[model samples]
Target: MEKRDSMDAFGAVSLIGFAALIAFNQVVIAVVNEGLQPVFFAGLRSAGAILLIWLWMRFRRIPVMITRETIMPGLAIGAVFALEFVFLFMALDLTTVSRTSVIFYTMPVWLAIAAHFFVPGDRITPVKALGLALALAGTAWAILQRPDSGEVSLAGDLFALGGAICWAAIAFIAKATTLRNVTPHTQLLWQVGVSAPILLLAAPLFGDLVRDLQPIHLWGLAFQIVVVVSAGFLFWLWLLSIYPASGVASFSFLSPVFGVLFGWALLGEEVGPVIFGALALVALGLVLINRPARAQVPQKVA
Candidate 1:
């Protein structure tokens, strides 16, 4: 399919659905963390996802070969990817979904900052600067404010922040290194393939692999392997390939909103006024950051 310059109705609907899926995923992770140790669960997810990804590629006839140029960067991104999930999974385990979601979804803010330094032509415009300020403030606020009714932890918040940084670093590696030359499938394969063993080996140090093992947790792990890791991420990459990146990214703020809502509605996590205010600020900042610059009209000779 040809790339679109902007988001059409189909793209808009798809993005909304994707955002909701991701929001609900946070709740799923939190629940699944009950039966499995967080790091171990993440490792298992990565390990399972590798086989699924490989099968998908085989079915789609997408080559799985890694170029020599991309090998080092691929390994680097995979390591970073493992670290990202380790922090994120642990964050959800240690804190409320609402808090973790609000903080973890701050990935774009960190990505923007890194892009300014490393990604050529991706500078900090005035609008983006304002967006950064708002997002940073909101993130900080979300971290500092503790809810009266639900679980909150400084360690968990910091873990989420660290996850956000790792997420940004993965994006940076993709943008700044030879990894960008590879297919999305190959990039994903690298992440899961390399991270699986790293996560599994490291999982032992964190704790026993299993906790109060349950059927639902197994089901959740399957869901993560199939829906979230393989299909969900691929769907997102498909959208990015087709639609304008800025337009696609503009829908991201909805993830945290839906996340907070799902946490409140599903997990019965608290959503106080402070959290809502932080959400508002971050959402507004995301809008500003992703808002496209107006086109310049060429003037005729006067």
Candidate 2:
């Protein structure tokens, strides 16, 4: 089977898998929040992911050439990573999964929009434009639906939006800066390694670090470190390295769809007609965006 530069079968499958893992992650965070304050948990997760990735890198003998050139931009990316999770974890704590997911997963659209201006080959195509439009519509529709129980937090919604922007900013940095040449492992290290300390220092300001800390919570943190951060984020950046930014960005639209389903199944949250319809739009958009266009060949006149 041939692998194309846009989105190949493996790329599509990998992206969908990543989206599902991230969707399921929201539920895990909600559960873990029972034992840990959001910021502290996020900080600890980053710390854990750093250690995990470092071990993997060491075992594999992956040389992360951290020269003077990569240091400043690397720290900047890590700072962006810190801000992204700070807002995201807080959003998860303050809002329902459905609401936060709908709001937060808009990062792809934010990223595509920025990449259009900054990235050379990542300019929005007609299909991607359509996808972005539908994505925004679906996300907005999902956000508008009132939850059955817990009152929605405006602050949480805003935090989610901020997190989306921060997420976009990271993609922009990767595409538009020298960091593009850096290995995905090193890029991820910049994020988790730098974020660990920044987040840890800020964690205490948010209040108590631990709630009713339990064994399952420890397990949850471990899952986040191993699967979501270490494995999932690394996979995402790797996808970006091999595929077009717009195509990869478009696939992330599935996350909120999975998020809503998980929220319904795991948290017993309501999934109504509006959400179902929105999920369809998002899924449809993903198909459209990922469908590779064929070359138009000119015919000679006889």
Candidate 3:
């Protein structure tokens, strides 16, 4: 659980960097989907991230020691991490990046709702409530505006929702379990290390592992493992350990905004007027939800 630490400038920068990284990730996932099956690609990245993280730690002389106290929680988070990506990758394959991002980035709403009951100091204030309404409305708008000419899928939307919930589950578990006390790398180790084998095993179940295999796909997988899975997640965990999670989480709204624009510019995906309007609402809500208050935002501790 986080303490009542509010967001500072450095925290804001970190959130922005993370948001951009993940926003770009949507484009990468879409590109990679051409050569690798969604689930299979996810599984490969999970496993590859394990090696990358280990190599990184080794180079940094950071010892990754797992004590008995951490095993169970680590394993639990690992499983959740695996499931989260499975749904996410599948959703990306089944739908456009704009649509998938619109739905998937609703994570803050779900997290706030769970925090209201499970986390102390997380009660939604009037402003926050309004923010939630706006954000949720934006998500609903995105789901509804399946542009007849654009690619959209119900199954994909559901899977994206599932992925968002699982994302919240990871946050909740981190707050509630011993993970809160561990180092960021240790926490990430639990996720990628545990998730690797499980995902690799499940890959075959999703059918053929390879598509029109290409060098670019391999490079994309490397980016997912080294940049996103290893470095990005570790940084997020560290942020969670130091800053108020609510503030950190509020930044997630930027991902969809960035994702949609990137999708259009990079992938040539259509962005309808409805999506632009939805982005406005979601952005407004995030600004309010993350607005600095008089008191430090109390992060929930299990």
Which candidate has the top score in lDDT? 1
lDDT string for model 1 (1-302, tens) is 78998789999999999999999999999999999999899989999999999999999999977888999999999999999999999999888888887888888988989888878888888998999899889999998887654468888989999998999899889879998887888899999998999999999998888999899999999999999999999999989989988999999999999999999999988788888988888888888888877778999998
TM-score of each: 0.97, 0.87, 0.89
How many residue pairs of model 3 clash at the backbone? 0
Please tell me which model should have the higher TM-score, number 1 or number 2: 1
lDDT of 2 by residue, 1-302 (tens): 33356677788898889889999999999889889998899999999998889898899899886988888889999999999999988888877777777778777678778878877866788987997788778766766654555646677778888998998899778767888788889989999999999989998999999999999999999999999999888778777768876588667668888898899889887766876776777666655555556568999999
lDDT of each: 0.90, 0.82, 0.84
Clashes of 2: 0
RMSD of each: 1.2, 2.9, 4.7
Better of 1 and 3 by lDDT: 1
Instruction: Report how far residue 18 has shifted in candidate 3, in Å.
Output: 2.4
TM-score of 2: 0.87
Off by over 4 Å in 2: 1-13, 238-250, 282-302
lDDT of 3: 0.84
Candidate that would win on TM-score: 1
The runs of at least 3 residues in candidate 3 whose Cα sits more than 4 Å from the true structure, single-residue gaps closed, are 1-14, 239-247, 296-302
lDDT of 1: 0.90
